[model samples]
Target chain A: MRFRFTGIFDLFNQKNEYYLINKKLDTIIQINESMYKVLSNAKQGTELNCNEINLNTMNILIYNRVLEAIN
Target chain B: MKRDLNKPIVIHWCMNNCNKQGQIPKGVIEGKIRQAEPIKIRFINPRSQEDWRIIESFANESSDIKEIQVEYDFLEYDIKHCIDIDIEKKLIYLVAFSGTSYLDHDARNRLCNMIKKQDNFKIIVYISHKNIAESVCFIQSVYNEVKQGEFIIKPEKNIKNELTDISVLHEAISQIAELYKLFPDIKLSVYDEEKIVRDIIRLPYYMYGNMYITGDGNISMYSFMPAYNYGLSDPQVTLEEAWRKLYHEHATCDLEKILEYPRYWFKYFNRKEIK
Candidate 1:
């Protein structure tokens, strides 16, 4: 299934690490380079495999509605 | 000594409404932003084709800017301008205007058409209470017709009085919260529950990191704070230094009052009257 970021999210790079802030969810998540790449790819319309990302991370993200599944 | 004080995260560029020609040159604006390198750039009431083009250029450019927003105040001349060019950055558009005593069908239609042409344009319809009394029917017509925007019903005089009286401010907040419950889309100017929480976490208070700069080079950290009085008058002080100083001074914030006052109306207010 394809997934996209839901609502408005601000991505900022600080001290060589990336963080994603979602104002609607009142969330600020520190993302590793790999997770950042996955999000960047998804942003560019790349199909993401569910198994490619950690199950816990995916579950948390989906639970927060940060990443919504799209057909 | 806060880390973010090293530089302002956002800088607002406000154009001269009376004489659009009185604006700082585009090259100078570009130079300042490049030097300051704020995370976001906001253009407030950019009227002419030249203004739109500058906005379009900034929107299209690949830079450190995470957001580009426009707060457009409609005058007779503004309805003719539209954002037709392609933009890479997502823009948050807040539109507020005072209405005449009568319904302006032509202006309303023009506004609707302009809104139709863009994506991700969230408008905040802030009508002055006096105008509301005169043009309630006009406002209602636009409200029913324009389904894409957010609405805020506030009084003009309350801009100062509400801030000084905390109880009245609380009542206003309750009223706005009740309004939100009735209509989920309508929100208090700066009181989005999630946004408030997010702001607290990210900064000392909501809008703490944001600063405004006028065409003539005056700067202010808060909307209510007069740019002329609290501006970057001292050439020795850099943008970052001035911001840090202001941050230290206003630590005990007027959070509720700040939320009540709309930032766009900062320009419209007479300097002598605000206090």
Candidate 2:
């Protein structure tokens, strides 16, 4: 339903440039050059799955733990 | 589809005044069939004490759920009912640290440190503060730093009395301590009343989490938090994708990394890292 592009914007650890394509809504929000790097560098790729902790924590789980690396 | 074009089966953490959140909080039952049918209702935040009761009354109002879930994470008041696990999607809506208090950064650091200790977990964290990690990520990806505060949360109505006493704080800290005891293998550290962060030390690697609680009611870390994490939807709630989504973006998202873009973390926060 939603599509996005992610990659490093620079070598130093500043700026971001990611493009989000919401196909369902026909909208593309280009992230700032600084932020794109922060999100992408946050973690590496993996598979996402659902396990039950409570009742409300089940919607979208990514398969990667890469969200951590980012500050 | 599931409903009219104008309506989607939205899972809302309805607050007391559209900011407090939650209307009910039982495992599952029955309740009023309104715009969102077959959807569970839980009280998230409240303008007054009465707001929570109204939501609790509806917890069993719906006969659809088998159990109720509640989480009071905020320091001020029981913020609201947390998100239930959406099993099919492998996603979870997590409670976020959103206020502009010093506690905001503290909670974020705690969450980041706590969750990162594990190898497998997922959380679609809800954000309350702009400087908080999740909100920061969302802002960097979608909005300008100047506009990040747009989504900041406040008491829908200024009623005050949201702060907690030391006794209540003790109860919360102990509950988490017990949770750590239950899940021995999961990553966590028990808090010692006398020891502060700098004075803290780890258990011997060999003796780490080797103990367990017997059938008796003996309180033990070995039998607590890890099990708590294991039993709760926590195992299923934390998403591997959610973590990677941020990391992958961070890897190549820097302006310099992406087409020679230039940006700084401090530039956005506009605060020096008091070294």
Candidate 3:
């Protein structure tokens, strides 16, 4: 299934590491550079797939609500 | 009582109000402080084009401004020239607003980096609603990032919706207590000893004789209390004259009585009856 990032998540870079913070949930998690690139490249409302990133990472992102399945 | 006119004064640049309202009373900016000595001015939430125009005018017209305090969220442009000019003449105090949804993590990191390079900086965080845990986390993150500089936690004032719950106060106190345990170096701005003393003395805790300049170049005695606006700036009336007139007109028994009761005048002062 294709997925997109949720509005509650905000991306930030610190010490060359990317972090996704869920403001409403007050949860923060660090992500790898490749994951950062994939998330950053995915446009709003655009469906994201394993073609842009690995399935395992995409699954984790979807589970965290950082990405929502579109299809 | 005779007041020293030459003494340094603090002024608030109420940019948020000015940007929203378009203009402020001119009398608020023209005051005894301007005539006496170089003043310290803090610009709050200054982001709009009108706010920048006002800042430019102040930079051009006034040589008496000794310090400029600005928050990081509002700065979108290159203010290197402004900083250079101030460094040559006065001081610039960069401030960061912590523990709010106003700034994202990237912005916070950028702010922390900027603050680390500057000697004069402060991080002012607010505790409100049910965001004590979030605030604590934000403050801890900031503390870990920036080792130097002043940190203060201010209790947010509930004005419009009248959601002034005693529980919010309790939460803020508890949050501060928790913060102290986490970061003992953190400071409390609202409940400080100096503020308590000011409350006991029946005097306005802060911004007593201060002036506030709006975006449209208007002035008021108090920033938040816009009911006391003097009027627009006029070449006919000097700032000193405006100050004298506004103070003379408003510094009455009614104002004194309001000042006497902390519950009525001070927003930070929390009492059981206030809620």
Candidate 4:
């Protein structure tokens, strides 16, 4: 199934570090450089195959409503 | 997003002589004057007839100006009778500032007296002093004299910090905590239910439908980001031309930009989870 990040998240770069802010929950979670790239893509509506991305990262994003099924 | 050109919620009109850079265009006023609906104007620290003349000129052009508020900076200028004239005319709602280093004893007394006299004004006391006793005393003195007026304590240390610095957020949270401990009655500006909901929805609260004119005649749509600077624009460029640059170059309130800006209260709220 194809998936994309929800609208509740936004990307920010503070002090050369990438952080994801949940606009709905007003929470911040720092993500690694690679994770940042993936999420940035997701934010731009890039679709991801469930098996392609890191499972743990996908699980966290899905669990937090950061990602939702495209279908 | 396209804003309703007809109605501008507020115009921050800085009437000071100092060349501090106003970001709102003269064209905004000129454009708004042609409309029937009067725009609200907040006069920032108006001190002279020159400022009043500007107000009169706008008033003469159109009846589009419905409300006027004065941000009275008591420290910089004396209590002028021109303000009294407007207040008497029911044309002014006052927002006065008083605090350490900003207001001397005599000035504080003058501010307090004005507050007591006016029924339509709020006094904001910015507390930046290290001594808690001194801070409390400053607040008490104002309250004691006025007897029935509200004063907001803005705990700012007068230090400029890069917006990206997390340490600054920590310092702000600590200061707020200190204030809460001493003055439990002190209210946070964020307690407004509407504003809370707006923040959650990522809607613009302060910057929504408002524009600014800085002291030096620079025009900006958002206070967080300045669109025009005299250094970048030509020295003889008109505010109309400057405003065009702002309109083309910047989004009024980009969500990514707003999220990136340092909202210390958000950090304070999600302190444990921010890392």
DockQ for every model, please.
0.12, 0.02, 0.01, 0.02
Chain B TM-score of predicted candidate 4 relative to the true chain B: 0.62
RMSD of 4: 14.6
Model 4 C-alpha lDDT per residue in residues B112-171, reported as the tens digit of each score: 776777765565544433433454566555555566555544534223323225575455
How does chain A of every candidate compare to the true chain A by TM-score?
0.76, 0.28, 0.74, 0.84
Sort by TM-score, best first: 1, 3, 4, 2
Best by TM-score: 1
Summarize candidate 3's per-residue lDDT along A1-71 as a digit string, tens digits.
66677765666554454555443222234566877767776635555657877677666667656778776
* Proportion of the native interface contacts kept in model 4: 0.00
The candidate 3 chain B region of ten consecutive residues with least summed lDDT is: B1-10
How well is each residue in B1-275 modelled by candidate 3, as lDDT tens digits?
11222222445665565244565443344343345443455666666665555555555564645455564442354445334454423334545443555566776666677567766566666556656677778767776778666666654553321214556666666766776786666543443322332343342212234455555655554443333445445545555555556556653433454455544334334223334
The TM-score of candidate 2's chain A against the true chain A comes to 0.28
| Root mean square deviation (Cα) for candidate 3 | 20.9
Summarize candidate 1's per-residue lDDT along B1-275 as a digit string, tens digits: 12233456667777554554554555555555656767667788776677787877777777777778787776435533466435523676666554453326776676676556655544443434334333344444554566555443434432443322456545545544554464456323433332243335434212355666776666665443455434344444467766666566652243333444544233234354443
Q: After superposition, how far is residue A40 of candidate 4 from its true place, in Å?
A: 45
Off by over 4 Å in 2: A1-71, B1-8, B11-13, B18-36, B65-73, B78-94, B103-275
Question: Over all chains combined, what TM-score does candidate 2 have?
Answer: 0.24
Between the candidate structures 2 and 4, which one is better when assessed by TM-score? 4
Better of 1 and 2 by TM-score: 1
How well is each residue in A12-69 modelled by candidate 1, as lDDT tens digits?
Answer: 6644555565543223455677777777776666777787798877876786666889
lDDT of 1 at B242: 63
Colliding residue pairs in candidate 1: none
DockQ of predicted candidate 3 = 0.01
The Cα error of candidate 1 at residue B54, in Å, is 3.0
